[model samples]
Target: GQQVMQIPQYQHVQEGEDFTTYCNSSTTLSNIQWYKQRPGGHPVFLIQLVKSGEVKKQKRLTFQFGEAKKNSSLHITATQTTDVGTYFCAGPPDSGYSTLTFGKGTMLLVSP
Candidate 1:
């Protein structure tokens, strides 16, 4: 069995500040996926990191994969109220992506 855990279960940041959330897994992962869920909306796929030491960015957001493929992180620079949401990190327990194990999630709360 595999487990995914996220830290700083909740975060509060002022607008224009920066925010980050880290994810760790008990077992090495083949790939990791990130999802964002707004206050009233369902989870939306943010990005996926596959290769070791891989890093990707979307606007002010950056995603990183650990060299060991057992950890990941998401950072938001100049955060905004719109960025408020619960961010989840997920990894497949087996070989396929059909099933995924998700972390408890880090909930980001941004204020003006």
Candidate 2:
């Protein structure tokens, strides 16, 4: 079965630092999507990469698609207390939606 895996399920950072997370899939994916969920909030779309070896950035955050489209990563230049939340990497489902199957996610905790 095709499934995505993420490491360092949890992370803690101080204000004004930096953090990065990685994602991997057992099988190749057609596309991948990254989402963020703030505390007490629903998942929000951040960005999506379709082409192989694609990379995109939003402010201090950077997203990348692996050359094989089977892995992805998110990097935050600098951390902030408001950066506290869970970051998820979702890939196309093996069966339907072709949309994405979200990994458990990497939770970020920022301290003031």
The runs of at least 3 residues in candidate 1 whose Cα sits more than 4 Å from the true structure, single-residue gaps closed, are 94-97
11: Cα error in model 2, Å: 0.3
Flag regions of model 2 displaced more than 4 Å: 93-99
- Local accuracy of candidate 2 as per-residue lDDT tens digits, 13-107: 88888999999998888888999999999999999888889999999999999998889999998788878999999988534566667899999
Output the worst ten-in-a-row residue range by lDDT, candidate 2: 92-101
What is the C-alpha local distance difference test score of each model? Answer: 0.93, 0.89
TM-score, one value per model: 0.95, 0.92
Per-residue error for 67 in candidate 1, Å, reads: 0.4
Candidate 1 clashes: the total is 0
